[model samples]
Target: MLLKNPQILYALFLLIIPVIVHLFQLRKFKKEQFTNVKFLKKVQLQTRKSSKIKKWLTLLARLLGLACIIFAFAQPYLPETSQSLKKKETVIYLDNSFSMQQKGKNGELLKNAIQSLLTALPEDYHFSLLTNDEIYKNTTKQELAKELQQINYSSNSPNFKTTYIKAKKVFSKHKNTLKKFVAISDFQEQNLKDLEFDAQLENTLIQLQPEKNFNISIDSVFVKDKNIENTTVQVNLSSSTATDQLFTVSLFDHHKLLAKSSVNFDDNTKANTTFSIPTSQDIKGVLAINDNSLQYDNSLYFSLQQNEKINVASISDAKDNFLKKIFNQDEFNLITTQSNQINYNKLSHQNLIILNELKSIPQGLANILSKHLENGGSLSIIPAETINEASYNRLFNALNLSRYQKKQTEELKITNINFSNIVFENVFNKKVRNFDYPKVNSHYYLNTGANQILSYNNGQPFLKQIKQVFLFTAAINKENSNFKQSPLIVPTFYNIAKQSLQLPQLYYVNENNNTIEVKVKLDKDNVIKIKDSSKTFIPLQQHFANKVNLTLQNEPKSAGNYSVIANDKTINLLSFNYNRRESKLNYANLSSYKHIKTQDSITNFFSQEINDNQMNFFWKWFVIFALLFLVIEFLFLKFLK
Candidate 1:
C-alpha cells in the first residue's frame, strides 16, 4: 500500500488529542448525605460498574473513528506487480510493404495482427502508429486504424536507416519522458540487420514471416534496325533460381500475338532471345515473360514507324562530287541545279534544301526558304569556300542568327555530344578520330530561342538549333581548309541531313512532372484524337504550326504500360516504374526487447506515477465511519440515562 499524498499522513498526530481528552475527563461529585447505607451499597456498586463499562466503550469507538479518518486522509492504494510503472509515450511502427499482403489461413496477416493488438491495449494507454508508407504521431486509435485500411502495397519502400534516424529526432524533443517503440514487419534477408537503435528509445522489434517462392522476370529489351526491311528485338530474362527452368516468351502488336517461343536457362544464367518484327506493318506492342518480381519490367513496349524521305536540291558552281555521293543515300532524293536556274517554288515540296558552297544566295531564294520554314519546313545552310559578309548575313538573318563573328582555327576536337536528342540517335556509333574541320572563319551565334546541340572544345557551336531548324556552319570543301577530309566529315554531313529530314511518328513523354508539351509535325492541318481506357477521344487543340501541349493530369494510379495517341500517329507510349528497394518487407528483429521494462511488468497496474490529481475518496469513508461512531455514542448515552 502506498499513499498518493504522503504529507497528509501527519494527520495521524490528531489521535493524541483524542487520547488526551479521554484521559482528562472531569467528573462532578455531589456532596450528598449517605442515607440508607444498606440499600445504597448495593445500588452504588451496580451503577459504578455500568458507568465504567459505558465510558470505556464510548472512548474505544471515538479512537477507532479518529484513526480511520487519519488513515483515509493519507489516500492509500495497492501497487501492481506484473509490469513496471509507465510514465512515457509509446510509438508503434507497423510495416505496410507489399510483403505484408501475404495471407494466412484465415485472412490477411496484418489484419489479424492489429486485432490482437486492439484486444491487449490498455484503456488509458496512449500510442502513435508508424508505417513503412509514412509515420503518424500523436494520433488516436480510430484515426490510425482508418489510415491503416487505406494503405496498400507500394513499389517504393521506406529506408529503415533513414526512418530510424527520424524517429530519434522525434523522441529527443521529448527527452524527459520514457519512449517505447515497437516495430512489426517481415524479416526478409535484405531487411535491416544489426541496426543500432537510438539509445534513448526503448524499442521492441517484431519480425513477421511470409511464404516465399522463386520468380523470373525480363530484365531488359532492345530493338535494333539496320534497314526498313529487317528489325530485330532482343529480350533478356533474369531469374532467381540456379536450376534449369523453362519459360515462354511472347510478342504482341496492339493486342495481336505475332509470335511465341520457349527457352530453357541454365542455373543462375541470363537467357537471351531475339524476335524479328515485320517492318511492313506499323508495329506497336509489348514483349512479355511470366515472372513475379515486378510487373512493370516484365513487359517491354516498342513501336516502329515508316521513315520519312527528304528531297535535297544542291546548287554549286562546280560539280561537288563528294556532296553528290553523300546525298545519294537511299533516304535522300538529291537534285543538282545551277544557283541562278534553281526554282524557288519547288523548294516548298522538299523537306530540306542545301546551298552547297554558293558565293551568294540568289535574290528571291532566301525569302522563299524563310517563308517555307516559317510554315513548318527544315533547312540546312553550308557556306561557300569564299563568301562575302553581306551574302552571309542575308542567309544568317533569315535563320534567326543573333551575331556572326569570325575566329581563327585552333587545334581542337569535338569531344562532347548530346545523346538524349533524337537527331543524333545512333548516327555516330564510332568516335571521329583525328577529324579536323575547317576553322570556322566566321560563325553565327544564337541567342534566345536557340539551343547549342554540339560544341567544340573552345565552346564554339559545332551544331546549333533554333526552333526546329538545324544549321551546320562548317566549310564543305577542302580548298578553304583540310576539314572536309577529316573523320568528322561523314558524321557531320550525315547528322545534319538526317535531323533536317526525319519526321517524328512516335513521341516519348519523358517529363518528371505530370504534364508534357508536344508539337505535332504533320504535312497537313488535321484533327488529332487522344484517348485513354474509357475510349473517349479528346480532340487536341491545334495551335498555329500544329503545336499543342498534352496535359497529363496526374500519374497513372498503377505502374504499368500507358499510351497516348494523336490521330493515326501514336504520340507517346511510356512505362511508369517506381523504385522497388522500398518494397522490401524485412523488419528489424525484436529479440533485444525481451528484457525491457514496460507497464505490464510493474507492481501497481492502475497506479500512475506522474498524475497526482486522482481522487482517493479515503476522507469520505472516514467521515462515514465517524458518523456511525457518533450514532452509537448517542444510543449508549440514552440507554445509560
Candidate 2:
C-alpha cells in the first residue's frame, strides 16, 4: 500500500471535536428528596450504566468511520510489486509497412496506433521510435507528435530479424541503466518467419494491432513471354479468407483502362488473371484488383521494352550454305565473315554469335569472344570436322569453358529436349507424340559443367547451355548432318536470338535484392536519374564495362512506370511495385508470447504499472462509510434515550 498524499492524514486530529462534544454534552445530576428512596437509587444506577454503554459505542463508531474517510482522501493504492525506480530508456518500434493499411473500427491500424501512443505516453518519458525504413532517437513529446504525423506507410516489409537487429543497434548507443523495449505491429505471420531475439530482454513489451475485417490483395504480375509480339501478363490474386470471393481485375496503360474483368472464385482461394497485350511498342501498365481494405497491394506496375530486330553474326572458316540461309536478311541483320576476315569491333552490337567449324581459335579471338559473352551476348559453339584439339583446348582454357574430348563417330539421335526450359515457352501449341528426333553423324565428347537442354540416345548431351554460352556437340551442314533441315532448327535459332536481347524484368521489388543491372554503356561522369511523371531523383549507381548497376534505395516508392534517364535521354522504362509479402495477411499468434498486451489493454496496463495505480480512487467508498456511521449515531440518540 502507498499513499498519494500523506499530508491528508493530519486531518485525523479533527476526530477530537466529536470527543470534546460528547464530554461537554453530558447530562448534569442534582440531589432531590423523593418518596421511595430505595427504588429511586436502583433506577439511577441502571440508567447511568445504560447511558455510559451507549456513549462509548457511539464514540467508537465515529472514530472508525472518520479514520476511513481521511485515509481515502490521502489516496492510497497497491503499488507494483517491483520498485526499481531507475531512470528508463524506452525504445518503440512502430510497423509502418504497407500491410498496416488494414482498417479497424477506430481507423487504419497505423493511424490508430499513433493516436494511442500519443494518448498513452507521458511527456517526461523520452523514447526512440523505429519504423520499417526510418528511425528517431530520444524523441521529446513535441518532436514525437511532429514525427508521428509525418510518418507514412512504406513499401519495404522488413522481417522481424532485421527489425530486431536495427532496434538493438539503436538501443546500444543509449547508456541508461534501465531500458525498456516495445514493439507495436499487426504481427503478420511472415514477419516472424526469421525472428531472432534475445530471450532475456529487460522490460520487453509488444502491442499487437489486430485487424477487424478480411483482405484480398494482388500478389504479383509477371510477363509470361517477351519474345513474341503479343505477350501474356499474368496477375496473381490471393485472399486471407478460407471461403472463395469475387474480385474485379483491371489492366491500365498509363492510366488509360485497357482491359477489365470480374473473377468468380467460389471453390478456389488463389486465382490468376492474364491479359494479352501487344509488345510492338514499349508497354507501361498497372494490373489492379478492386480491394478496399488494403489498397497498396491492390495494383502492380510493370514495363516491357519493345521488340527490336535481332543482330546475328556468324564466324566460320568457309561460307556454310545452311547457316546463311537460316539467318535470312529479311528478319535478322546477319553478318557472315570468314574466320580471318572477322570484324571484332562490330561483335559488340550483335545479339547472338555462331562460331562455326574453325581451324583453330587464336588467343586474340578467344579474348574478344569472352568479352562478348560477358556483355550479355549469347554464343553457340559448333565443333570443327577436322579440328585442332590442342588449339581448341587453349581457347577453352582461356574462357574457362570445358575442354573437348576425343571425337565419337557413333550415329546418335537426340532423345530428350527439356520442354520446361524458358527457351521452349510458347514454342508448341500442343504436346507432340512420336516426334522424329534429329540425328548427329559425329560429335566430340566434353565434360561440360552446364545445363543440358538436348540429350542424345546414348546419354550424351547433343546441346548444352550455361548462362550466356551455348554448346553443340557436332557441326550442322549437309555433309556433316541433316540437323539444319529439321523442324527444330528454325525455332531453335529464333529463340537463341530472342533470349540474347537482355529483356528487362516487367517489374522489380527490393524485398531481398536492391540492385539491378542495366545493359547500357554510359560516360563515367554522367548521372543516372529514375523518374516518373510525378517524381524524379538520382539513384546510386556503379558503372561497368558495358552495363550499369543501379542501386534502388528508398526509391520507386509508388507503383508505376518510371523512366531511366541519362544526360536527359530516355534510355529505358522501368517498373516497380510494392513487395508482395504484405499481401499475406496471415497474422502472428500473439497468445504465444508470454509478455504481450493487445492494443486495447496496453495503454491502461502501462498507466497502472508506471503511475503505480494512483488513479484508482477510493474516496467514494470512504464517503459512504462517513454517512453510514453518522446514521448509527442518530439511531443511538433517537432510540436509546
Candidate 3:
C-alpha cells in the first residue's frame, strides 16, 4: 500500500477535537423536580445510564467516519511493482522465415502471430520489431501493424544468438533501465543450440507451433540422362513422418502441364520419378507436389537452356588419334596446333587447355598457362619420357603442381578410385569393385600436393588434381604404358575436359553462396542481369576474357526460372529454389532454459505484462468506507435510542 498525497493525512489530528467535545458536554442540563421521590430517583438513574451509552457510541462513529474521510483524501494505492527509477524498453523479434507458412489453429503461423501482436500492443505503446530481412525501431502499434501486413516470406534463415545481440543493440544504452525482449517464432532447432540469454534482461520466448508435423517436400531435381534427342529429368521427394502415402507430382512449363506422376513414400521416407523432354528446346520448368503441411518446399524451379559446344584446345607434339575420338565435333570445338604453330591470341578463348606431351616448356608458354589458371581455365599436363626436367619444373612451379623427379622403369597397377569427388558425380550407377586393373610401366616417381583420384597398388598417386590443374605421372604412349587401352581412360580424360567448363546446374539454392559460370563475351563496361517476370537485378559478377562468374547473394526472392540478359538479349536461363532445411519441422524445447520464460500465445504474454505494470488505486474503496461509517452513525441516532 502506498499514498499519493500523504500530507492530507495530517487532518487525523482533527479527530481529537470531536473526542474533546464529546467529553465536555458543554450544554448543562437543568433537572426538574419529579412528582414522587422514589419515581424521580429511579427515572434519573435509568436516564443517566442510557445517556452514557448513547454518548460513547456516537463518539466512536464520528471518530471513525472522520478518519475514513481523511484517508480517502490521501489517495492510497496498491503497488504492483517496486519503486522503479529506471527507464523501460521493449523489443520484439518476429520470425518471417518460409517455415512460418505452416498452418496452426487459426491460420498460417506468421499470420496468426501478427494478429496476436496487433491485439496485444496498446495504441500509444512503442517498441522495436526485428524480422528476418527488415527492422523497425521505436515504432508505435499503428506503424508496426502496417509493416507486418506487408511482410512476405523470407529466404534468410533464423539464428537466435544473432537475434539476441541485435535486440540488445536496439535498446538504448542506459545503466539504470528495465529491458524486456519478446521473441515470437516457431523455434526451429536449426540455429538455437548456442544461444545464451542475458540474466539481467527479461526474456519471453514464444513458440508458435503448427497443428501437425507431417510434411512432404520436393527434395531435388536433376538431369538423370541426356542424349542428342531427349533428356530425362529426375525428381527426388522426402517426407518428415513415415507413412505409406502416395503423392502426386506435376511438371509444368510455365502454365501448360507437361507430365504427371505418382510417388509412393513408404517407411523409407524417399521416392523419385522421372520425366523425359526434348533436349533441343529451351525449358522453363516447374516441379510441384501437393503438400498442405508446408507450401515453400512443395515446388521446385529449374531451367534447361540450349546446349553450347565446349572449346577444347590441344597443344600437342602430333595429332593423337585417341584425342580426336574423345572430343567429337558435335559437342566440342577441337583445335589442334603444333608447338611451333601455336596461336597465342586463340588460347584465351578456350575452356580447357591441354599441354599434350610437351618435350620442354618455353618461358612464354609457362606464363600463358599461369594466366589461364588465374582466369579460371583448366589445364592438364602429360610429360614426355625423357624431357628437359628443368623447363617442366619451372612450369610446375608456376601452376602450383608437383614436378617430375628421377624416372623409374618399374611397373605399378592403378588400384584405388575416389568415387566421392564431384568430378565422379552421377558418372557411375554403382561403385564397381571388380574391374580390369590398369597398369603403367616406366613411370616417373613424382611428389604431389593434391587429391589423388587414381592411385597405384603401392598407394602412390597416379593421377592427381589440385584446383583446376590435373597431372598424370606416367606417359600414355603405347611404347611406354598400355594405360591408353584401359577402361578408366575414357571417363578419366573426358570428364576432366567436360568439368573444365563449369556449366550452370539445373537449379541453385537461393541465398546460398552459389557461383555459376556463364559462357558469354562481355564488352567493356557492359553488365548482365538476372530477371523474372516481376523483378530484375544485377548479380555480383566477375568477368574473364570469355565468361562471367556470377555469385548470388539474395536477389531472387521466389522459386522460378530466370533469364540471364546481356545486351537486351536472353543469353541463358537459370533457376533458384528456397533451401529445404526447414521442411522437416524440427523445433527446440525452450522450456528447459532457466533464464527464459516461454509463452504459448503473444496475447497472453502481453496481458501479463500489462497486469504487472498496472497500478490499482484504493481511494474509491476508502470513500465507500467513509460513507458506510456515516450511515452507521445515523442508524444509531434514529433507532438505538
Candidate 4:
C-alpha cells in the first residue's frame, strides 16, 4: 500500500475532535421523587449503562469514518511493483523478424503485438522503439504509431543479448530516475539464450506471442553440378511437426514452371529433393513449397550464369601437335606462343596457362606467372623431354611447386583415377576396371605435396593437383606417354578450364556475410550496382586484380533474381533468399523471467491497469461512510432524547 498524496493525511488530526466531543457531552443529573425507590434505582442504572455503550459505539464509528475520509483524500493505492518511482522512460522492442510472421490468436504475431502496444501503452512514459534492423529513441506515441503501420518483416534477426545490450545503452542516456523495457516477440529459445539483464533496468517485461499452427519451410536450395545440360538442383525442406504429410514442391525459371515434385515427410524432421532443368543460358530460378501459413520461408530463389569461353595460353619451345589436337578452337581460344616470344600481358586474361614441354622457364616470366597464380589463376606444368633440371627447379622453387628429379626409365601404366573428383562427377556411368590404361615410359621422378588425380602402376603420381595448379609428371608426347591419346584427356583439361571461372553460389543469405565476389573487373569510372525488376541500387564495392567484391547493404529485401551490373553492362546474375533460422517455430519460456508478469489478452491488461485500478478511486465509498456515521450520531442525540 502507498499514498499518492501523503500530505492530505494531516487531516487525520481532525478525528480526535469527535472523541473529545463524546467525552465532554454528558446529560445533567436531575434528582426527582419516584413512586418505587428500588425500581427507579434499577431503571436509572440500566439506562446509564446502555447510554454509555451507545456513546462509545457512536464515537468509534465517527473516528473510523473521518480516518477513512482522510485516507481517501490521500489517494492510497496497492503497489503493483516494489519500485514506487514514477515511470519515465519505456523502451519497447518489437521483433519484426520473419519468425514473427507466425499467426497468433489475433493475427500475425508482429501485427498483433504492434496493435496491442498502440492501444494499451500508458501515455505518461516516453517510448523508444527498437526492431531487428533499426532503433528509434524518445519516440512520440503518434510517431511510433505511424512507424508501426510501415513496419514489415526483416530477414536479419538479432538475439536477445544484442537487443538487451542496445536497450541498456539507450536507457543509460536518459537522465530519468525510472526506466523500463518491454520486448514483444515470439521469444524463440535460440534467440533468447544467456541474456544479461541490467540492474539499472528497474522494470522489464517480455510479452510472448504464442504461435498457433505448425510451419513448413523450404530451408535451402542449391545447384549440385552446373556443368551438365540438365542441371540438378537440391532443395532442403523442414517441418515443425513430425507428423506424416505430403507436400508439393515446384521449380520455376524466369517465372515459368520447369518441374514439380511431391515429397512425403513421415516421422522425419527434414527431407531433401532434387529437380533437373535443361538450361544453357544464364537463368533465374525459384523453388517453392505449398506451405501457406508461413509464406516468407515457403519459397527460395536462385540463379545460374551461362558458361563462358575459357582462354587457354600454351607456351612451349614449339607448337606441340598433341596440345593442338586436345584444345579445340571451338571450346578453347588456344593461344600457342613460342617460349621466346611469349607475351606477358596475355597471361592476365587467360584462365589456364599451359607450360607445354618448356626447355627452361625464364626468371622474369616465372615471377609474373607466380603473381598470376596467386590471384586465382590456374597453371599446368608439362616438362620437356630433354629438360634442364637446374632451370626447371629454379622456376619450380620460385612458383612454390614441387621440383622435378632424375628421369626413370621404367614403363609405368596409369591405373588409378579419382572417381569422386568434381572433374569426373557425371563423366562415367560405372567404374572403370581392367581396361587398357594409358602407359608412360621414361617419366621424371618428382617430389609432390598434392592430391593424385591419376596414378601409375607403381603408385607414382601421374597427374597431381595443387592449389590452382595442375602437374603431369610424365611428358605428353605420343612416344613417351599415351596420355594425349587417351579418352580422359578431353574432359580432364576441358573441365579444368571451365572450373577456373569460379561458379557463383546458387543463392545468398542476408546475415553477417553480406559480401559477394564476382569474376568481373572494374575501373575507377565503373560502378558495381545490383538491380531487380522493381528496384536498383549501387552497392559498395572494391576491385581486385580480376574480380569485384560487392558489399550488399541490406539489399534484396525480398527473394528473387538480381543482376550484378558493371556500369551499364549486366556482368552477372545473383540469387538471394531469406535466412531459415526463424522457421524452427520454437518459443522461449516466459515464466523464467524473474520480475515478469504474464497476461493473455491486451483487454485484460488494460482492465487491470486502468479501469479497475488507481484512477478509478474508492474515495466515494469512504465519503459515503463518513456521512452515514454522522447521520447515525445525530439520530442517537436527537431522536433518542
For all candidates in order, the CA lDDT equals: 0.59, 0.75, 0.85, 0.77
**Residue 502 local lDDT, model 4:** 52
Query: In candidate 4, what are the lDDT values of residues 466-499, reduced to their tens digit?
Result: 8878888877777788787789888788777766
Cα displacement (Å) at residue 431, model 1: 8.5
Indicate whether candidate 1 or candidate 3 has the larger TM-score.
Answer: 3
Global local distance difference test of model 1:
0.59
lDDT score for residue 315 of model 4: 89
For model 3, residues 1-641, the per-residue Cα lDDT tens digits are 77878999999998999898888887865788877989888888897888889888977987888888899899988767763224688899999988899999999999989888888887877789999888899999987778888888888875778878988999998868789899999988877878889998889999999999889999998889988899999999998877877899999997889999999867688889999999987889999999888898988999987757788898887347788888888778889988788898999888899877778787688889888888878888887777789899899888877778888788888888888765566678998688888787877877744588888888777888888888888778887778889887788878888887767788988877888888888897899999999999998999887888988877677878899999889999899999898887889988777688888899989888777767778888888888888898898888876
Task: Estimate the TM-score of every prediction.
Answer: 0.60, 0.68, 0.78, 0.64
RMSD of each: 8.7, 9.8, 6.8, 9.3
Clashing pairs in 4: none
Q: For every model in order, what is the number of clashing pairs?
A: 17, 0, 0, 0
RMSD of 3: 6.8
RMSD of 4: 9.3
Tens-digit per-residue lDDT, 195-252, candidate 1: 5666667765555554443445655566645455777777777655554667889988
In model 3, the Cα lDDT at residue 162 comes to 88
- Model 4 TM-score is 0.64
The true-versus-predicted C-alpha distance at residue 471 of model 2, in Å, is 4.8
lDDT of 4 at 301: 87
Off by over 4 Å in 2: 1-80, 172-179, 194-197, 202-211, 222-234, 242-246, 272-281, 317-345, 362-364, 370-378, 397-499, 510-527, 540-554, 593-600, 612-641
